[model samples]
Target chain A: MSDPIEFYYDLSSPYGYIGAHLIEDVAARHEREVLWKPFMLGAVFKEEGTQPLVFYPKKGAYARHDMARTARLHGLPLNFPEKFPQLTVNAARIILWAGHQDQAERKRLSLAFYHGIFGEGHDISDKAVIRNICETHGIDWAEAEAAMADPAIKDQLKEETQAALDRGVFGAPYFIVGDEPFWGVDHLPQLEKWLESGGW
Target chain B: MSDPIEFYYDLSSPYGYIGAHLIEDVAARHEREVLWKPFMLGAVFKEEGTQPLVFYPKKGAYARHDMARTARLHGLPLNFPEKFPQLTVNAARIILWAGHQDQAERKRLSLAFYHGIFGEGHDISDKAVIRNICETHGIDWAEAEAAMADPAIKDQLKEETQAALDRGVFGAPYFIVGDEPFWGVDHLPQLEKWLESGGW
Candidate 1:
């Protein structure tokens, strides 16, 4: 079997919410596995010396419009939580935990986190909201919360972020196939094409 | 006739080079007119409190890769100069001058500037290079130079830059179709769909 596509994203990213839904289906068509990896986009930002999209001057306004418009064009739901671009360190810990469970559970938890922030506009950072997601999805809330605090997992996420930096990932919804990297949700079509063909 | 699709670009932008070619063709297919407008991206950058794509650490590297990848995928040639993200003020001046002429002439100059920078990797900020392009294209060099330096023309470019800010244009290859704005060359697909369907 071919190597699984490395799919990296921050759960708080609106584009990542969309890509979380996209990469799996694209992979499925080509009979490929996706290794879903969640990391802190903020950490990536700090390394890259950049700010969040909505914090910029002109790009900020355009990002808000593009976010909704792109969502509408794709027929995706977006409520855009009031605490947008919320500090997603806590949410990412749970997603990393879920990734260890299994592929199906990983996708479920990832999508639930996305939907919480973008689809339903819920504060995903809140432990209660995360707990609700865990309860509804049949995950062990106690273990999940406990795992979040595990120094090992916290260190793992930090290490994962460093690995992402090493691999040149600076944005959410970043995909890696072999040494090639694709960033943003917009490149999914190109990604699918790359998969369909050996490469152009 | 419907309003011309306001095509905004910075001549220094590789994506803008691609967009310069793409927007016109897309507009022609939709039977729409394209208003080729050149503005100072530096001015926009100042207002946006941002830097160019190639200056953002990891994003800088990713951007260099993506720029080439995207160009190749779309079958556009890129002869990126050692000096990219060039001071495009001179090239933009020529473009604005051409825009004041017939549409064909505007496109000719725009593509010439794009080809000179991204296609040929010539240092377009230099007067000699601009002179070469003008000579090859039968443009009046002395007058074009005069236009570039004209205080009124310089003010006009400034006004256009401010106008773009007013319209919420934040980046190169920004498109305004009706009241809706689309930023980035990747959003071209959505822009074409919008033209085809009237709206989403």
Candidate 2:
């Protein structure tokens, strides 16, 4: 069997939310599991010597329009959280922690986080929001909260971010299929085609 | 008649080359004309405070791969020029000059320039290469050379670039259908849908 599609994303990325919404179905069609790996996009940006899409005024405004338009195109709900590009360290930590326990639950927790941020404009960076999402997902809030404070989990995110950089993941919604890297949610069509044809 | 689909691009942009190749057909399917406008992407980059895709180490490598992969996906030939992101001022000037004469010829000359740069890896920044392309396209080489040197034409390119900035064009392969702006060749699907549905 082919390896699972390694999906790398950040909690603060709108495209990442859209990707999380769509990747599973795409994976299912090709009979592949998705490994949801969340890392700090801020770390990637700092290393790449770039800023978030909102840093550039023109690109930022276009990105906001594009984000909503893209979400509409994909039939997904998107509402910008009051604090955009919020600190996602803890959110990422919880996801990594969830993955340590169960991969499926990790995907679930990640999607719930995405829906909260983009679908409902909830600040997932808040621990209360995180705690509430944990409750909704049947994940133990106490363990999840503890994991967020765990040094090992914190280090794990840093390691995963470094690993992502080593693998040339410089953007959110980045996917690795058998060592082939595809970036951006827009490339999902090409990603699917690659899976269907194996390589073209 | 419906307004022409305003296509803003740069000769140095690979995605712009691909968009130039595919946009005419997409326009024809929906019965629209194309207005090919070449501007200085370097100017846009400066104002936006962003570097070209190749400036970042990791994204640069991924872009090289993605450009080739995207070209293949579109079934278009792509060979990187000896000097990529080359000074495209003169190339843009010649295109703008051609537009002053005939829009069709302008598009033809623009495609010829794009094919010369990306298809055959020619250094388009060279005036000799420019002269050769002009001659092959049945354009008067002497007149084309004069246009490239004309201060008015040089200023026209600047004005066009500034106008692009005013219109929120921060990247190549940017399209404006009516007042709606779409960036990137990948967004052509959405652009077409917009043209088909007016707005969605």
Candidate 3:
């Protein structure tokens, strides 16, 4: 692989979780390394002036149907998180710390956070739950928690979030390769095709 | 055809222009009546808290590129309008008036306006330009202009726009067959397929 694909995601987003697995498969197939960049979705939304829902009153219903259809189409088991719109600051911080330590560990924890919320309905906002996820991934919970509390790590996450906004990213689960940003998980195949075409 | 497939459009939108041509082709193939609905995009945006460009500075560039790609994929000629984000109040009013007079004439004018703005780089905001478009479509400009200025016609346009927003329409060039709103022009094939399946 010449350059690794940068996968920007947040743990709270269902589509981000979906793309996490799908991107792994695509990256493995193409022998491309995915540089997972977990960032603050709230910050991105604030900077971009994007509402949480596309349609206000009807968004919940539409989202449910859209997610169901997407899950069915992708053959993935998906259910709405009980504690939806949860705070993902710690999750992003841990992923950033994990990335600094080991690439595989970062990818493992990213999926764990996703599964914790989206798959198992666990409230990832709880530090204890996040600690459990860290321990399960064979990462030191104390160190992960310590790193998350570090102001430097929080600043790094903030910087990355601003960078994403500056790069024309309006939504979550943006995949960037060769300075070309693909906004949504739905555009993954197009991203893969772009990758195969020698990084457009 | 049980009921005519409602084709909702705003003249200032490039995608609406592109869709105008494609809808005609689909209607001809499926043997359905295409009801041209000319409604103000600005009014819809105001009611729905939607900005023409999603309230992000960079989105405009991404949208332009994405629209170009979509147009290319559909084999349609498209040029981004110079006075992009042009006012469509008059254009929409004329479309509503033309719809009342003749559906075919409305469709023709819709295409003409789309072509004039996106294809030929003409100033769609000009009253004379709109009058010329009406005349070119075999609509009497004086009567069409008069109808456009009628308060009742303006009220009807607002009603149509409000109805579209109530029906979960957030963007331009929306199509509705029954209760299903096929959002973008790209969904036309799927809409046709749905129609062919006898409304299952």
Candidate 4:
């Protein structure tokens, strides 16, 4: 069997939301396992010597059009979150905890967070909103919150984010098939094609 | 009938090439007309207070993947140019002159230039090569060369590029449907959708 494809993502990115849904279908087609790694985009930007908006000042406009176009392309309801660039530290921690329990649950929580943000325009930064998302997915919100507060989990998220940066990951929805890293949700199809062709 | 969509492009841009092809098909689908405007990307970047490369270092790596992925998506041979950032002054001038005679020929030459640089890795800056391309398309090479050398045509190209800068066009492949400026080739689909919905 081929090695599982590693997908690194951040909860704050709308493209990550698109990847969350689309990658599943692509992976299923290739019969590839997916390793979901949720990390901090802020830390990645800081380490890369850049700011998010500085790279593209017209990002706000582009992002809006991208969401609409992506929605039309994928038949999904994609709206901007009320408070964008939401604090996803707690969300990342919870995802890490869920990954320890069940990979499927982790995937579920990832999509729920995305839907909550881009679908309903919810304040993902709000702890209460995250708790509600957890509850909707049959996740234990109390335990999830407790795990988020754990210093070890906080350190782990930070360490993992640093690891992503060290791996030359500049953006979310980055897919690493071997040593080659394909960044952005747009590259998902190419990753699948590579996997299907059995090419390194 | 609605006003034609004004397309601002630079001959040296790979994305502009992709956009040129995609927008033509999109216009055909929506029964819309496109007015092609060839401009200088270097001058536009200077006025925007940024260089395209400086805006995103990751873009270098991402651009390669983007080309490959877009090729796979569109099923086109998108060979990246060897000598990028070509002296597009002559190319832009020829395009402007061609636009006066035959708009379709101007569009065809623009695509041919894109293919020459991006698909065949040719040095489009070479006058001989440019002449070869012109002659291949049934254009009088001497007349075309003379038109390119005309001071009035050269000034007209410069004026058009400057006009684009004044109108907030800071990037290549900018599309203006009425007063709204849609920058970047990726936004072509949205521009098409907008035009289909009766010009936003």
- Index of the highest-DockQ prediction: 2
lDDT of 1 by residue, A89-167 (tens): 8777877776776877778888887887899999988889889988888889989999889888899899999988888
Per residue, candidate 3 scores C-alpha lDDT tens digits across A69-112 of 55655677776777778898988888887777577878888888
Q: Which lDDT value does model 2 have at A68? A: 95
Model 2: how far residue B115 lies from native, Å: 0.9
What order do you get sorting by lDDT, best first?
2, 1, 4, 3
Can you tell me which runs of candidate 2 are displaced by over 4 Å? none
Error of 1 at B130 (Å): 0.3
C-alpha RMSD over true interface residues, model 3: 3.6
Give the alpha carbon lDDT tens digit for every residue of B13-48 in model 3: 777887888887888887888888877777777766
Docking quality (DockQ) of candidate 3: 0.30
Lowest summed lDDT window (length 10), candidate 2 chain B: B97-106
Alpha carbon lDDT of residue B65, candidate 4?
67
Q: Output candidate 2 Cα RMSD.
A: 1.2
Q: What is the DockQ of each candidate?
A: 0.82, 0.83, 0.30, 0.19
| iRMS, all models | 1.1, 0.9, 3.6, 4.9
Given the true complex, what DockQ would model 4 score?
Answer: 0.19
Q: What is the TM-score of each predicted model, taking all chains together? A: 0.97, 0.98, 0.84, 0.78
